[model samples]
Target: MKRYTDADTYDNKIPSVVTIGTFDGVHIGHKKIIEQLVEAAMQNNLESVILTFFPHPRMVLQKDTNIKLINTIDERIQILEKTGLDNLVIHPFTKAFSRLSAGEYVEKMLVEKLNVRHVIIGYDHRFGRNRNSNIIDLASYGIQNDFTVEEISKQDIDNVAVSSTKIREALLDGDITKANVYLGYNFMLTGKIVRGKELGRTLEYPTANLHIKENYKLIPKKGVYIVKSEIENKTCYGMMNIGNNPTVNGTHQTIETHFFDASFNLYDRKIQIEMLKRIRDEKKFDSVEDLKMAMQQDENFSREYINSIL
Candidate 1:
Protein backbone atom coordinates (compact mmCIF):
# COMPACT_ATOMS: atom_id res chain seq x y z
CA MET A 1 0.00 0.00 0.00
CA LYS A 2 1.15 3.56 -0.73
CA ARG A 3 1.49 5.88 2.26
CA TYR A 4 1.37 9.65 1.82
CA THR A 5 2.38 12.02 4.58
CA ASP A 6 0.33 14.75 2.99
CA ALA A 7 -2.50 14.82 0.49
CA ASP A 8 -0.54 17.20 -1.71
CA THR A 9 1.73 14.31 -2.61
CA TYR A 10 -1.10 13.04 -4.80
CA ASP A 11 -1.70 16.39 -6.43
CA ASN A 12 -1.11 15.17 -9.97
CA LYS A 13 -3.04 11.94 -9.58
CA ILE A 14 -6.74 11.38 -9.86
CA PRO A 15 -8.85 11.58 -6.74
CA SER A 16 -9.33 8.25 -4.97
CA VAL A 17 -12.00 6.78 -2.76
CA VAL A 18 -11.22 8.21 0.67
CA THR A 19 -12.35 7.45 4.20
CA ILE A 20 -11.53 9.85 7.01
CA GLY A 21 -11.31 9.14 10.75
CA THR A 22 -8.92 8.85 13.64
CA PHE A 23 -9.08 5.02 13.33
CA ASP A 24 -7.35 5.03 16.68
CA GLY A 25 -7.64 1.43 17.76
CA VAL A 26 -8.54 0.02 14.33
CA HIS A 27 -11.11 -2.01 16.22
CA ILE A 28 -13.67 -4.37 14.72
CA GLY A 29 -15.90 -1.45 13.70
CA HIS A 30 -13.03 0.19 11.88
CA LYS A 31 -12.43 -3.07 10.08
CA LYS A 32 -16.04 -3.09 8.91
CA ILE A 33 -15.63 0.44 7.58
CA ILE A 34 -12.40 -0.42 5.81
CA GLU A 35 -13.99 -3.49 4.25
CA GLN A 36 -16.78 -1.32 2.90
CA LEU A 37 -14.22 1.22 1.71
CA VAL A 38 -12.25 -1.41 -0.17
CA GLU A 39 -15.44 -2.61 -1.78
CA ALA A 40 -16.35 0.93 -2.77
CA ALA A 41 -12.89 1.52 -4.20
CA MET A 42 -13.05 -1.74 -6.16
CA GLN A 43 -16.45 -0.90 -7.63
CA ASN A 44 -15.30 2.54 -8.72
CA ASN A 45 -11.82 1.45 -9.79
CA LEU A 46 -10.39 4.03 -7.37
CA GLU A 47 -7.56 3.61 -4.94
CA SER A 48 -8.67 3.02 -1.38
CA VAL A 49 -7.34 5.62 1.01
CA ILE A 50 -7.51 6.24 4.77
CA LEU A 51 -7.09 9.74 6.13
CA THR A 52 -6.11 9.94 9.79
CA PHE A 53 -4.57 12.51 12.11
CA PHE A 54 -1.65 12.72 14.48
CA PRO A 55 -1.32 13.77 18.18
CA HIS A 56 -4.97 12.63 18.54
CA PRO A 57 -7.15 15.72 18.44
CA ARG A 58 -8.10 15.34 22.08
CA MET A 59 -4.46 15.59 23.16
CA VAL A 60 -4.24 18.89 21.33
CA LEU A 61 -7.66 20.17 22.39
CA GLN A 62 -7.31 19.32 26.05
CA LYS A 63 -3.87 19.98 27.43
CA ASP A 64 -4.73 18.64 30.88
CA THR A 65 -6.71 15.64 29.68
CA ASN A 66 -5.86 12.14 30.82
CA ILE A 67 -6.49 10.47 27.46
CA LYS A 68 -4.40 7.34 26.98
CA LEU A 69 -4.21 6.14 23.40
CA ILE A 70 -4.60 2.51 22.44
CA ASN A 71 -2.27 2.58 19.43
CA THR A 72 0.68 4.71 18.35
CA ILE A 73 0.85 6.16 14.86
CA ASP A 74 3.16 3.37 13.76
CA GLU A 75 0.87 0.76 15.25
CA ARG A 76 -2.18 2.38 13.73
CA ILE A 77 -0.45 2.41 10.37
CA GLN A 78 0.44 -1.25 10.64
CA ILE A 79 -3.18 -2.13 11.44
CA LEU A 80 -4.49 0.03 8.62
CA GLU A 81 -2.12 -1.55 6.14
CA LYS A 82 -3.57 -4.92 7.06
CA THR A 83 -7.01 -3.70 6.00
CA GLY A 84 -5.90 -3.88 2.36
CA LEU A 85 -6.25 -0.18 1.69
CA ASP A 86 -4.26 1.11 -1.24
CA ASN A 87 -3.18 4.38 0.31
CA LEU A 88 -2.98 6.06 3.69
CA VAL A 89 -2.77 9.82 4.17
CA ILE A 90 -1.60 10.96 7.58
CA HIS A 91 -2.64 14.54 8.18
CA PRO A 92 -1.15 16.77 10.82
CA PHE A 93 -4.06 17.95 12.95
CA THR A 94 -2.87 21.34 14.01
CA LYS A 95 -5.03 24.05 15.56
CA ALA A 96 -4.96 25.92 12.28
CA PHE A 97 -6.26 22.95 10.37
CA SER A 98 -8.99 22.49 12.95
CA ARG A 99 -10.11 26.04 12.32
CA LEU A 100 -10.99 25.35 8.73
CA SER A 101 -14.70 25.59 7.96
CA ALA A 102 -16.24 22.33 6.83
CA GLY A 103 -16.71 23.52 3.29
CA GLU A 104 -13.26 25.06 3.03
CA TYR A 105 -11.63 21.79 4.14
CA VAL A 106 -13.60 19.72 1.66
CA GLU A 107 -12.89 22.19 -1.14
CA LYS A 108 -9.19 22.55 -0.55
CA MET A 109 -7.90 19.38 1.05
CA LEU A 110 -10.40 16.73 -0.03
CA VAL A 111 -11.79 17.96 -3.36
CA GLU A 112 -8.93 19.92 -4.86
CA LYS A 113 -5.87 18.30 -3.35
CA LEU A 114 -6.83 14.66 -2.86
CA ASN A 115 -9.10 14.53 -5.88
CA VAL A 116 -11.39 12.52 -3.66
CA ARG A 117 -13.91 10.92 -6.01
CA HIS A 118 -15.93 9.12 -3.37
CA VAL A 119 -15.73 10.16 0.29
CA ILE A 120 -16.79 7.59 2.87
CA ILE A 121 -17.55 8.71 6.40
CA GLY A 122 -19.43 7.32 9.35
CA TYR A 123 -23.04 8.40 9.66
CA ASP A 124 -22.36 10.50 12.73
CA HIS A 125 -18.91 11.75 11.83
CA ARG A 126 -18.21 15.45 12.17
CA PHE A 127 -15.34 17.73 11.20
CA GLY A 128 -14.14 21.34 10.80
CA ARG A 129 -14.34 24.32 13.17
CA ASN A 130 -16.08 23.28 16.38
CA ARG A 131 -17.00 20.08 14.57
CA ASN A 132 -20.11 21.83 13.32
CA SER A 133 -20.02 19.71 10.20
CA ASN A 134 -21.90 16.43 10.17
CA ILE A 135 -22.47 13.78 7.54
CA ILE A 136 -25.55 15.63 6.32
CA ASP A 137 -23.50 18.76 5.80
CA LEU A 138 -20.71 16.82 4.12
CA ALA A 139 -23.16 15.05 1.85
CA SER A 140 -24.64 18.38 0.83
CA TYR A 141 -21.19 19.68 0.03
CA GLY A 142 -20.43 16.56 -1.98
CA ILE A 143 -23.64 16.97 -3.94
CA GLN A 144 -22.75 20.55 -4.82
CA ASN A 145 -19.13 19.65 -5.60
CA ASP A 146 -19.82 16.67 -7.88
CA PHE A 147 -18.40 13.98 -5.61
CA THR A 148 -20.18 10.98 -4.10
CA VAL A 149 -20.64 10.84 -0.33
CA GLU A 150 -21.09 7.45 1.29
CA GLU A 151 -22.33 7.43 4.86
CA ILE A 152 -21.75 4.10 6.52
CA SER A 153 -23.99 2.94 9.32
CA LYS A 154 -22.49 2.41 12.71
CA GLN A 155 -21.53 -1.23 13.28
CA ASP A 156 -22.84 -3.13 16.24
CA ILE A 157 -22.15 -6.67 17.39
CA ASP A 158 -24.52 -8.48 19.73
CA ASN A 159 -26.37 -5.20 20.12
CA VAL A 160 -23.28 -3.53 21.58
CA ALA A 161 -21.67 -0.84 19.52
CA VAL A 162 -17.90 -1.02 19.39
CA SER A 163 -15.98 2.17 19.98
CA SER A 164 -12.51 3.39 20.82
CA THR A 165 -13.68 4.71 24.19
CA LYS A 166 -15.15 1.36 25.24
CA ILE A 167 -12.01 -0.44 24.12
CA ARG A 168 -9.87 2.00 26.08
CA GLU A 169 -11.97 1.44 29.17
CA ALA A 170 -11.63 -2.31 28.75
CA LEU A 171 -7.84 -2.05 28.42
CA LEU A 172 -7.48 0.33 31.35
CA ASP A 173 -9.38 -2.14 33.48
CA GLY A 174 -7.08 -5.02 32.39
CA ASP A 175 -9.95 -6.74 30.65
CA ILE A 176 -7.81 -7.73 27.69
CA THR A 177 -9.95 -10.75 27.03
CA LYS A 178 -12.93 -8.47 26.54
CA ALA A 179 -10.90 -5.87 24.69
CA ASN A 180 -9.55 -8.45 22.27
CA VAL A 181 -13.08 -9.62 21.56
CA TYR A 182 -13.86 -6.08 20.45
CA LEU A 183 -10.48 -5.59 18.80
CA GLY A 184 -10.74 -8.85 16.84
CA TYR A 185 -7.19 -9.76 17.85
CA ASN A 186 -4.87 -9.78 20.81
CA PHE A 187 -3.62 -6.36 21.94
CA MET A 188 0.06 -6.14 21.09
CA LEU A 189 2.97 -3.92 22.02
CA THR A 190 6.04 -3.65 19.83
CA GLY A 191 9.32 -2.12 20.95
CA LYS A 192 13.05 -2.57 21.06
CA ILE A 193 14.42 -4.66 23.89
CA VAL A 194 16.38 -2.76 26.49
CA ARG A 195 18.71 -3.68 29.31
CA GLY A 196 17.35 -4.40 32.75
CA LYS A 197 18.87 -5.41 36.08
CA GLU A 198 19.29 -9.04 34.94
CA LEU A 199 17.10 -10.25 37.77
CA GLY A 200 15.53 -12.82 35.51
CA ARG A 201 18.92 -14.22 34.51
CA THR A 202 19.95 -14.43 38.13
CA LEU A 203 16.79 -16.43 38.78
CA GLU A 204 17.41 -18.75 35.76
CA TYR A 205 14.56 -17.18 33.79
CA PRO A 206 16.30 -14.84 31.39
CA THR A 207 14.08 -12.03 30.13
CA ALA A 208 14.07 -9.31 27.51
CA ASN A 209 12.89 -5.90 28.62
CA LEU A 210 11.09 -3.61 26.24
CA HIS A 211 11.53 0.15 26.01
CA ILE A 212 8.06 1.19 24.96
CA LYS A 213 7.24 4.45 23.21
CA GLU A 214 5.90 7.02 25.64
CA ASN A 215 3.10 8.46 23.56
CA TYR A 216 -0.05 6.86 22.14
CA LYS A 217 0.40 3.61 24.03
CA LEU A 218 -0.95 2.40 27.36
CA ILE A 219 0.22 -0.58 29.33
CA PRO A 220 -2.30 -2.84 30.96
CA LYS A 221 -2.83 -2.72 34.70
CA LYS A 222 0.12 -3.98 36.71
CA GLY A 223 0.04 -7.77 36.40
CA VAL A 224 1.67 -10.84 34.95
CA TYR A 225 0.31 -12.19 31.67
CA ILE A 226 0.66 -15.03 29.21
CA VAL A 227 2.01 -13.65 25.97
CA LYS A 228 3.41 -14.66 22.60
CA SER A 229 6.65 -12.83 21.94
CA GLU A 230 7.94 -12.16 18.47
CA ILE A 231 11.66 -11.86 17.82
CA GLU A 232 13.32 -11.92 14.42
CA ASN A 233 9.82 -12.28 12.96
CA LYS A 234 9.21 -15.53 14.80
CA THR A 235 6.66 -16.07 17.54
CA CYS A 236 7.48 -17.89 20.74
CA TYR A 237 5.66 -18.79 23.89
CA GLY A 238 6.51 -16.48 26.78
CA MET A 239 5.50 -14.99 30.06
CA MET A 240 5.37 -11.25 30.71
CA ASN A 241 5.39 -8.98 33.70
CA ILE A 242 3.89 -5.50 33.72
CA GLY A 243 4.54 -3.78 36.99
CA ASN A 244 6.86 -2.07 39.40
CA ASN A 245 8.78 -4.75 41.23
CA PRO A 246 7.51 -4.28 44.72
CA THR A 247 9.54 -7.20 46.02
CA VAL A 248 12.75 -5.50 44.91
CA ASN A 249 11.54 -2.07 46.04
CA GLY A 250 11.63 -0.91 42.42
CA THR A 251 9.01 1.69 41.45
CA HIS A 252 9.35 1.80 37.67
CA GLN A 253 6.60 0.11 35.71
CA THR A 254 7.98 -1.99 32.88
CA ILE A 255 7.28 -4.83 30.45
CA GLU A 256 9.62 -7.76 30.97
CA THR A 257 9.32 -11.05 29.09
CA HIS A 258 10.98 -14.47 29.28
CA PHE A 259 10.83 -16.72 26.24
CA PHE A 260 10.20 -20.30 27.36
CA ASP A 261 13.25 -22.47 26.67
CA ALA A 262 14.82 -19.87 24.35
CA SER A 263 17.86 -17.84 25.27
CA PHE A 264 19.93 -15.30 23.37
CA ASN A 265 21.40 -11.84 23.86
CA LEU A 266 18.34 -9.78 22.85
CA TYR A 267 19.50 -6.36 23.94
CA ASP A 268 18.31 -3.63 21.54
CA ARG A 269 16.37 -6.10 19.42
CA LYS A 270 12.87 -5.22 18.24
CA ILE A 271 10.13 -7.48 19.52
CA GLN A 272 6.35 -7.60 19.48
CA ILE A 273 4.49 -9.13 22.39
CA GLU A 274 0.89 -10.21 21.89
CA MET A 275 -0.77 -10.25 25.26
CA LEU A 276 -2.89 -13.41 25.66
CA LYS A 277 -4.22 -13.65 29.18
CA ARG A 278 -3.80 -12.01 32.54
CA ILE A 279 -2.32 -14.45 34.98
CA ARG A 280 -2.33 -12.58 38.23
CA ASP A 281 -1.90 -9.18 39.81
CA GLU A 282 1.58 -7.94 40.56
CA LYS A 283 2.56 -9.04 44.06
CA LYS A 284 5.46 -8.51 46.41
CA PHE A 285 7.11 -11.74 47.37
CA ASP A 286 8.85 -12.24 50.71
CA SER A 287 12.27 -13.01 49.22
CA VAL A 288 14.15 -13.76 46.00
CA GLU A 289 13.47 -17.47 46.43
CA ASP A 290 9.73 -16.78 46.82
CA LEU A 291 9.73 -14.62 43.70
CA LYS A 292 11.53 -17.25 41.70
CA MET A 293 9.05 -19.90 42.77
CA ALA A 294 6.13 -17.67 41.85
CA MET A 295 7.67 -16.99 38.46
CA GLN A 296 8.05 -20.71 37.91
CA GLN A 297 4.34 -21.17 38.52
CA ASP A 298 3.60 -18.31 36.16
CA GLU A 299 5.77 -19.82 33.47
CA ASN A 300 4.14 -23.19 33.87
CA PHE A 301 0.69 -21.67 33.57
CA SER A 302 1.74 -19.66 30.52
CA ARG A 303 3.11 -22.67 28.72
CA GLU A 304 -0.01 -24.64 29.52
CA TYR A 305 -2.25 -21.82 28.32
CA ILE A 306 -0.39 -21.51 25.03
CA ASN A 307 -0.53 -25.23 24.53
CA SER A 308 -4.24 -25.33 25.22
CA ILE A 309 -4.96 -22.47 22.84
CA LEU A 310 -2.86 -23.62 19.89
Candidate 2:
Protein backbone atom coordinates (compact mmCIF):
# COMPACT_ATOMS: atom_id res chain seq x y z
CA MET A 1 0.00 0.00 0.00
CA LYS A 2 1.18 3.51 -0.80
CA ARG A 3 1.13 5.80 2.26
CA TYR A 4 1.02 9.56 2.05
CA THR A 5 1.52 11.92 4.96
CA ASP A 6 1.13 15.16 3.04
CA ALA A 7 -2.19 15.26 1.20
CA ASP A 8 -1.31 18.59 -0.47
CA THR A 9 1.62 17.00 -2.35
CA TYR A 10 -0.33 13.83 -3.18
CA ASP A 11 -1.12 13.79 -6.89
CA ASN A 12 -2.85 10.76 -8.37
CA LYS A 13 -4.04 10.41 -11.93
CA ILE A 14 -6.56 7.67 -11.16
CA PRO A 15 -9.63 8.73 -9.25
CA SER A 16 -10.10 7.01 -5.89
CA VAL A 17 -12.98 5.27 -4.10
CA VAL A 18 -12.43 6.58 -0.59
CA THR A 19 -13.46 5.91 3.01
CA ILE A 20 -12.48 8.15 5.88
CA GLY A 21 -12.25 7.47 9.62
CA THR A 22 -9.87 7.09 12.52
CA PHE A 23 -10.26 3.27 12.17
CA ASP A 24 -8.64 2.99 15.57
CA GLY A 25 -8.84 -0.77 16.11
CA VAL A 26 -9.57 -1.76 12.50
CA HIS A 27 -12.12 -4.06 14.08
CA ILE A 28 -14.51 -6.32 12.19
CA GLY A 29 -16.92 -3.47 11.44
CA HIS A 30 -14.14 -1.33 9.98
CA LYS A 31 -13.04 -4.33 7.93
CA LYS A 32 -16.50 -4.67 6.39
CA ILE A 33 -16.43 -1.04 5.24
CA ILE A 34 -12.88 -1.43 3.92
CA GLU A 35 -13.92 -4.56 2.06
CA GLN A 36 -16.78 -2.68 0.44
CA LEU A 37 -14.48 0.19 -0.48
CA VAL A 38 -11.97 -2.16 -2.07
CA GLU A 39 -14.64 -4.15 -3.95
CA ALA A 40 -16.30 -1.00 -5.26
CA ALA A 41 -12.98 0.43 -6.39
CA MET A 42 -12.08 -2.80 -8.18
CA GLN A 43 -15.47 -3.00 -9.87
CA ASN A 44 -15.24 0.62 -11.01
CA ASN A 45 -11.58 0.33 -12.05
CA LEU A 46 -10.53 3.00 -9.54
CA GLU A 47 -7.95 3.01 -6.76
CA SER A 48 -9.05 2.35 -3.20
CA VAL A 49 -8.08 5.08 -0.76
CA ILE A 50 -8.43 5.36 3.00
CA LEU A 51 -8.14 8.82 4.49
CA THR A 52 -7.51 8.64 8.24
CA PHE A 53 -6.54 11.26 10.76
CA PHE A 54 -3.89 11.35 13.42
CA PRO A 55 -4.01 12.94 16.90
CA HIS A 56 -7.72 12.02 16.67
CA PRO A 57 -10.03 14.98 16.01
CA ARG A 58 -11.29 14.79 19.59
CA MET A 59 -7.77 15.29 20.92
CA VAL A 60 -7.38 18.45 18.88
CA LEU A 61 -10.82 20.05 18.79
CA GLN A 62 -12.19 19.08 22.18
CA LYS A 63 -8.89 18.83 24.04
CA ASP A 64 -9.89 15.35 25.11
CA THR A 65 -6.97 14.28 27.26
CA ASN A 66 -8.80 11.23 28.60
CA ILE A 67 -9.36 9.60 25.25
CA LYS A 68 -7.79 6.16 25.05
CA LEU A 69 -7.34 4.33 21.76
CA ILE A 70 -7.20 0.64 20.99
CA ASN A 71 -4.36 1.13 18.52
CA THR A 72 -1.59 3.64 18.04
CA ILE A 73 -1.22 5.41 14.66
CA ASP A 74 1.64 3.11 13.63
CA GLU A 75 -0.30 0.09 14.78
CA ARG A 76 -3.35 1.24 12.85
CA ILE A 77 -1.24 1.63 9.71
CA GLN A 78 0.30 -1.82 10.17
CA ILE A 79 -3.13 -3.46 10.52
CA LEU A 80 -4.64 -1.52 7.60
CA GLU A 81 -1.77 -2.59 5.34
CA LYS A 82 -3.19 -6.11 5.45
CA THR A 83 -6.55 -4.92 4.04
CA GLY A 84 -5.22 -4.66 0.45
CA LEU A 85 -5.87 -0.93 0.18
CA ASP A 86 -4.24 0.91 -2.74
CA ASN A 87 -3.59 4.12 -0.88
CA LEU A 88 -3.52 5.19 2.76
CA VAL A 89 -3.33 8.83 3.77
CA ILE A 90 -2.66 9.82 7.37
CA HIS A 91 -3.80 13.42 7.55
CA PRO A 92 -2.68 15.51 10.46
CA PHE A 93 -5.73 16.73 12.32
CA THR A 94 -5.28 20.29 13.51
CA LYS A 95 -7.62 22.93 14.92
CA ALA A 96 -7.46 24.91 11.67
CA PHE A 97 -8.40 21.87 9.62
CA SER A 98 -11.32 21.22 11.95
CA ARG A 99 -12.59 24.72 11.29
CA LEU A 100 -13.14 24.05 7.56
CA SER A 101 -16.75 24.26 6.45
CA ALA A 102 -18.48 21.19 5.08
CA GLY A 103 -18.33 22.54 1.55
CA GLU A 104 -14.68 23.42 1.83
CA TYR A 105 -13.86 19.95 3.19
CA VAL A 106 -15.61 18.21 0.34
CA GLU A 107 -14.37 20.55 -2.40
CA LYS A 108 -10.77 21.07 -1.31
CA MET A 109 -9.89 17.79 0.37
CA LEU A 110 -12.12 15.22 -1.31
CA VAL A 111 -12.51 16.69 -4.81
CA GLU A 112 -9.37 18.72 -5.45
CA LYS A 113 -6.81 17.02 -3.23
CA LEU A 114 -7.81 13.34 -3.32
CA ASN A 115 -9.62 13.21 -6.66
CA VAL A 116 -12.19 11.04 -4.99
CA ARG A 117 -14.71 9.36 -7.28
CA HIS A 118 -16.82 7.70 -4.61
CA VAL A 119 -17.10 7.87 -0.83
CA ILE A 120 -18.15 4.98 1.40
CA ILE A 121 -19.29 6.37 4.73
CA GLY A 122 -21.62 5.51 7.59
CA TYR A 123 -25.08 7.02 7.67
CA ASP A 124 -24.32 8.93 10.85
CA HIS A 125 -20.93 10.24 9.76
CA ARG A 126 -20.51 13.97 10.34
CA PHE A 127 -17.74 16.38 9.46
CA GLY A 128 -16.82 20.11 9.22
CA ARG A 129 -16.53 22.63 12.04
CA ASN A 130 -18.38 21.36 15.12
CA ARG A 131 -19.48 18.33 13.04
CA ASN A 132 -22.09 20.36 11.21
CA SER A 133 -22.36 18.06 8.18
CA ASN A 134 -24.22 14.76 8.15
CA ILE A 135 -24.32 12.00 5.54
CA ILE A 136 -27.16 13.80 3.75
CA ASP A 137 -25.10 16.95 3.57
CA LEU A 138 -22.15 14.97 2.26
CA ALA A 139 -24.31 13.40 -0.45
CA SER A 140 -25.58 16.84 -1.42
CA TYR A 141 -22.00 18.04 -1.62
CA GLY A 142 -21.14 15.02 -3.73
CA ILE A 143 -23.93 15.97 -6.16
CA GLN A 144 -22.35 19.38 -6.68
CA ASN A 145 -18.75 18.08 -6.61
CA ASP A 146 -19.33 15.32 -9.22
CA PHE A 147 -18.49 12.46 -6.86
CA THR A 148 -20.69 9.66 -5.52
CA VAL A 149 -21.62 9.08 -1.88
CA GLU A 150 -22.50 5.61 -0.66
CA GLU A 151 -24.14 5.43 2.74
CA ILE A 152 -23.48 2.33 4.80
CA SER A 153 -26.79 0.95 6.13
CA LYS A 154 -28.04 1.81 9.58
CA GLN A 155 -27.58 -1.85 10.58
CA ASP A 156 -23.93 -1.71 9.65
CA ILE A 157 -23.52 1.58 11.45
CA ASP A 158 -25.06 0.14 14.60
CA ASN A 159 -22.79 -2.87 14.37
CA VAL A 160 -19.78 -0.61 14.07
CA ALA A 161 -20.91 1.52 16.97
CA VAL A 162 -21.66 -1.41 19.25
CA SER A 163 -18.48 -3.24 18.37
CA SER A 164 -16.24 -0.23 18.98
CA THR A 165 -17.83 0.41 22.36
CA LYS A 166 -17.92 -3.26 23.37
CA ILE A 167 -14.33 -3.81 22.35
CA ARG A 168 -13.11 -1.04 24.63
CA GLU A 169 -15.36 -2.13 27.48
CA ALA A 170 -14.27 -5.74 27.13
CA LEU A 171 -10.61 -4.85 27.23
CA LEU A 172 -11.08 -2.57 30.21
CA ASP A 173 -13.01 -5.32 31.96
CA GLY A 174 -10.32 -7.91 31.14
CA ASP A 175 -12.64 -9.87 28.89
CA ILE A 176 -10.03 -10.63 26.26
CA THR A 177 -12.12 -13.32 24.56
CA LYS A 178 -15.06 -11.01 23.91
CA ALA A 179 -12.77 -8.17 22.85
CA ASN A 180 -10.99 -10.43 20.37
CA VAL A 181 -14.31 -11.59 19.01
CA TYR A 182 -15.39 -8.02 18.41
CA LEU A 183 -11.99 -7.07 16.97
CA GLY A 184 -11.56 -10.25 14.86
CA TYR A 185 -8.09 -10.51 16.34
CA ASN A 186 -6.27 -10.67 19.64
CA PHE A 187 -5.82 -7.43 21.54
CA MET A 188 -2.13 -6.55 21.46
CA LEU A 189 0.16 -4.51 23.71
CA THR A 190 3.59 -3.55 22.45
CA GLY A 191 6.33 -2.09 24.58
CA LYS A 192 10.02 -2.06 25.33
CA ILE A 193 11.45 -4.33 28.01
CA VAL A 194 12.77 -2.36 30.94
CA ARG A 195 14.48 -3.18 34.20
CA GLY A 196 12.28 -3.85 37.22
CA LYS A 197 13.12 -4.61 40.84
CA GLU A 198 14.26 -8.14 39.84
CA LEU A 199 11.69 -9.56 42.23
CA GLY A 200 10.45 -12.15 39.77
CA ARG A 201 13.91 -13.66 39.52
CA THR A 202 13.89 -14.27 43.26
CA LEU A 203 10.64 -16.23 42.77
CA GLU A 204 12.23 -18.31 39.97
CA TYR A 205 9.91 -16.69 37.45
CA PRO A 206 11.95 -14.01 35.73
CA THR A 207 9.78 -11.54 33.85
CA ALA A 208 10.31 -8.86 31.26
CA ASN A 209 8.93 -5.52 32.44
CA LEU A 210 7.18 -3.70 29.63
CA HIS A 211 7.10 0.06 29.17
CA ILE A 212 4.64 1.33 26.57
CA LYS A 213 5.50 4.78 25.24
CA GLU A 214 2.11 5.73 23.86
CA ASN A 215 0.05 7.22 26.66
CA TYR A 216 -3.11 7.11 24.61
CA LYS A 217 -2.92 3.37 23.99
CA LEU A 218 -5.35 1.74 26.39
CA ILE A 219 -4.02 -0.78 28.84
CA PRO A 220 -6.22 -3.64 29.88
CA LYS A 221 -7.67 -3.99 33.37
CA LYS A 222 -5.19 -4.57 36.16
CA GLY A 223 -5.01 -8.36 36.43
CA VAL A 224 -3.17 -11.45 35.33
CA TYR A 225 -3.74 -12.60 31.77
CA ILE A 226 -2.67 -15.40 29.49
CA VAL A 227 -0.59 -13.95 26.66
CA LYS A 228 1.59 -15.04 23.79
CA SER A 229 4.68 -13.59 22.16
CA GLU A 230 7.25 -14.58 19.57
CA ILE A 231 10.76 -14.80 20.98
CA GLU A 232 13.81 -16.34 19.30
CA ASN A 233 11.60 -17.18 16.32
CA LYS A 234 9.23 -19.30 18.37
CA THR A 235 5.80 -18.61 19.78
CA CYS A 236 5.97 -18.65 23.58
CA TYR A 237 3.07 -18.70 26.00
CA GLY A 238 3.23 -16.60 29.13
CA MET A 239 1.32 -15.23 32.07
CA MET A 240 1.33 -11.47 32.47
CA ASN A 241 0.52 -9.31 35.45
CA ILE A 242 -0.69 -5.71 35.26
CA GLY A 243 -0.76 -4.19 38.69
CA ASN A 244 1.15 -2.68 41.56
CA ASN A 245 2.72 -5.54 43.53
CA PRO A 246 0.94 -5.27 46.82
CA THR A 247 2.92 -8.11 48.32
CA VAL A 248 6.09 -6.16 47.70
CA ASN A 249 4.52 -2.82 48.58
CA GLY A 250 5.25 -1.49 45.12
CA THR A 251 4.04 2.06 44.51
CA HIS A 252 3.64 2.02 40.70
CA GLN A 253 1.73 -0.24 38.36
CA THR A 254 3.74 -2.48 36.02
CA ILE A 255 3.28 -4.95 33.21
CA GLU A 256 5.47 -8.03 33.64
CA THR A 257 5.35 -11.21 31.56
CA HIS A 258 6.92 -14.50 32.53
CA PHE A 259 7.25 -16.89 29.60
CA PHE A 260 6.96 -20.54 30.44
CA ASP A 261 9.93 -22.74 29.51
CA ALA A 262 11.66 -19.72 28.03
CA SER A 263 14.29 -17.35 29.36
CA PHE A 264 16.42 -14.75 27.69
CA ASN A 265 17.95 -11.35 28.23
CA LEU A 266 15.31 -8.99 26.78
CA TYR A 267 16.08 -5.93 28.83
CA ASP A 268 16.20 -3.55 25.86
CA ARG A 269 14.20 -5.45 23.24
CA LYS A 270 10.80 -4.27 22.12
CA ILE A 271 8.10 -6.96 22.21
CA GLN A 272 4.45 -7.28 21.41
CA ILE A 273 2.15 -9.25 23.71
CA GLU A 274 -1.11 -10.66 22.39
CA MET A 275 -3.56 -11.30 25.20
CA LEU A 276 -5.61 -14.49 24.99
CA LYS A 277 -7.53 -14.66 28.26
CA ARG A 278 -7.79 -13.21 31.71
CA ILE A 279 -6.49 -15.48 34.45
CA ARG A 280 -7.32 -13.75 37.70
CA ASP A 281 -7.48 -10.44 39.50
CA GLU A 282 -4.33 -9.19 41.16
CA LYS A 283 -4.37 -9.42 44.94
CA LYS A 284 -2.18 -8.76 47.92
CA PHE A 285 -0.65 -11.89 49.32
CA ASP A 286 0.03 -12.52 52.98
CA SER A 287 3.72 -13.18 52.38
CA VAL A 288 6.37 -13.52 49.62
CA GLU A 289 5.96 -17.31 49.71
CA ASP A 290 2.22 -16.99 49.15
CA LEU A 291 2.76 -14.72 46.19
CA LYS A 292 5.31 -17.17 44.76
CA MET A 293 2.82 -20.00 45.11
CA ALA A 294 0.16 -17.96 43.32
CA MET A 295 2.58 -17.22 40.51
CA GLN A 296 3.20 -20.94 40.06
CA GLN A 297 -0.52 -21.58 39.85
CA ASP A 298 -0.91 -18.80 37.29
CA GLU A 299 1.85 -20.31 35.18
CA ASN A 300 0.26 -23.74 35.33
CA PHE A 301 -3.17 -22.42 34.42
CA SER A 302 -1.72 -20.41 31.56
CA ARG A 303 0.11 -23.44 30.17
CA GLU A 304 -3.08 -25.54 30.27
CA TYR A 305 -5.09 -22.81 28.56
CA ILE A 306 -2.47 -22.37 25.85
CA ASN A 307 -2.20 -26.12 25.30
CA SER A 308 -5.95 -26.50 25.06
CA ILE A 309 -6.17 -23.83 22.39
CA LEU A 310 -3.32 -25.35 20.39
TM-score for each model: 0.93, 0.97
How does each model score on lDDT? Answer: 0.82, 0.91
Candidate 1, residue 259: lDDT: 86
Tell me the alpha-carbon RMSD of every candidate: 2.0, 1.2
**Candidate 2 structure quality by residue, lDDT tens digits, 126-217:** 99988988999998888898899998999998988889999999999999999999999899999899999989989998999999999899
Ten-residue stretch with the least lDDT total in model 1: 153-162
Clashing pairs in 1: 15-115
Give candidate 2 regions above 4 Å deviation.
none
Point out where model 1 deviates above 4 Å: 154-161
lDDT of 1 by residue, 230-289 (tens): 656577888888888899888788789888877667888777788889889999999989
Candidate 2's displacement at residue 185, Å, is: 0.6
